[model samples]
Target: MKLTDDHLQTFVEQGFVIVEDFYPEERRAQIAEGIRQTLPPWEVIADDPPARRLLTDDFPYADMLFNEFILDWDLIAFVQRVLDTEDIFFRYAHNWARYPDPGAEQPGLHIDNGNNSLLPPTSDRRYGQISTWYFPEAVDENQAPMQIVPKPYGQDLSKRVLLTVPAGTIMIFNTHLWHSATVFKGREGQRYSATRIYGRAD
Candidate 1:
């Protein structure tokens, strides 16, 4: 679906906006399964601590389903609206699965600039890069919810947003936003999400 003025306003104020059910469940399921299958065998990773992170590099190139999803016109248009540009370049993509790891330390909040972009980040939304995360299944608090700090709130712990959303949920945010991936607290269940990043062509 196209983004509305309210979405723009929210992005301007909070540095991000979450779009629920951006894609159909069936489509998301296919993408999720593709990613899962691309990963190493669960039994192998389950015993290897480092393998539990399950982050893939250049994942879109590994499968046609991922390539199509990244190139979908509707998704591009939605991101265009957020960046206020007609042309944008796909930066990169990766899929990740977070499993329960009570020993895992809380990740630090950081921006996706520097490494994701060649230029320095700007406060202006129009010139900022856009990053999105698509969750194929519901993400509850115990399943490692994403943590975001709104623009106005800065680093205030009280103002942080814990993204506990339903399946097919997509969160679009400025790459300059301060956000972090929380540890999975649940005893069972995995948190799988695909990420895509884009930047203004100019």
Candidate 2:
């Protein structure tokens, strides 16, 4: 779906926006299945403490489904508008699955750039990077939905957005936004999501 001006404004003001039904249900299912089948071969990156698994490294580039999804024209156009540049390039991609770990602590909210940030958060122009997260299945609060402070980094947490979206929903956010993932408390299954990072080609 094409992004409206309001959507762009929201991203600028709130530092993030969710686009529902970004992918069709059948297509989401196919992507979900592909992730499930493909993730098994990768070694568990962190299983002892948090039950984290990564389908990253060489896998994202090598996997046909992931490669296609990253280069989708619509997605690229959206990112281009946000960054105000046509010179966009894929930075990284990862499929993460986290199981319920009651004792595990939820991560603190923080911006993605950290020590590598080139510009301050108050800047009007976009810099650094942006990311898109795709949820193949519907996600509720129990499934560890991402919590984003509505304001830019270092601002007071006056408002927050908890992303409880339907299957095929994609959330795109500025890397400078303060955000963190809620702990998984659901009993049913793992919280599955695929993430792709993009930046100016230069």
Candidate 3:
């Protein structure tokens, strides 16, 4: 979906914007099912080193389901507008399953710039990278919503924005934004999300 003036302003001020109702429930389910089919059981991955390595080292784009979802024209156009560039390239894709862990604590907030680029962020955001996470499952407060600190807020924990949205929500954020994953407090099902990263060609 195209970003409106308000959405663009939010991204400019907060460094991130959540786009919802863009992908239909059916399409989201299809892409999610593909990921779940390939994903090994969490227990199996924990116990098997080879299984874990294979998953961590592999990219999900090999599957056409994921490819179509991430390569959709509308999504790319939206990203291009945000980066203000027609030259953009796909960086990577990964799927994550967040399950309930009894004593696990939320990790520290950090920018994606560390692994995405060597140079620091620019004032013009010309070299900025985009990290888009498509959530197939509706996220609730207790279901481990992503915590993001607005660009102007620095590392203040109290100023964090919790992303609690419906299914089929795609959140696009600049890589320089500080964010962290909170622990899953729900006792039942796990939360599923897939991320696709993109960077400017120049």
- Name the best candidate (by TM-score): 1
Q: How high is each candidate's TM-score?
A: 0.90, 0.83, 0.86
Candidate number that wins on TM-score, 1 or 2: 1
| lDDT of every predicted structure (CA atoms) | 0.80, 0.73, 0.75
User: Across residues 53-96, which tens digit of lDDT does each residue of candidate 1 receive?
Assistant: 54564754668888777887777787788778898999988877
Error of 1 at 77 (Å): 1.7
What stretches of model 2 exceed 4 Å from their correct place?
40-62, 114-122, 152-155
Clashing pairs in 2: none
Judge candidate 2 at residue 16 and give its lDDT.
80
Using lDDT, rank the candidates from best to worst.
Answer: 1, 3, 2
Better of 2 and 3 by lDDT: 3
Better of 1 and 2 by lDDT: 1
Each candidate's number of clashing pairs is 0, 0, 0
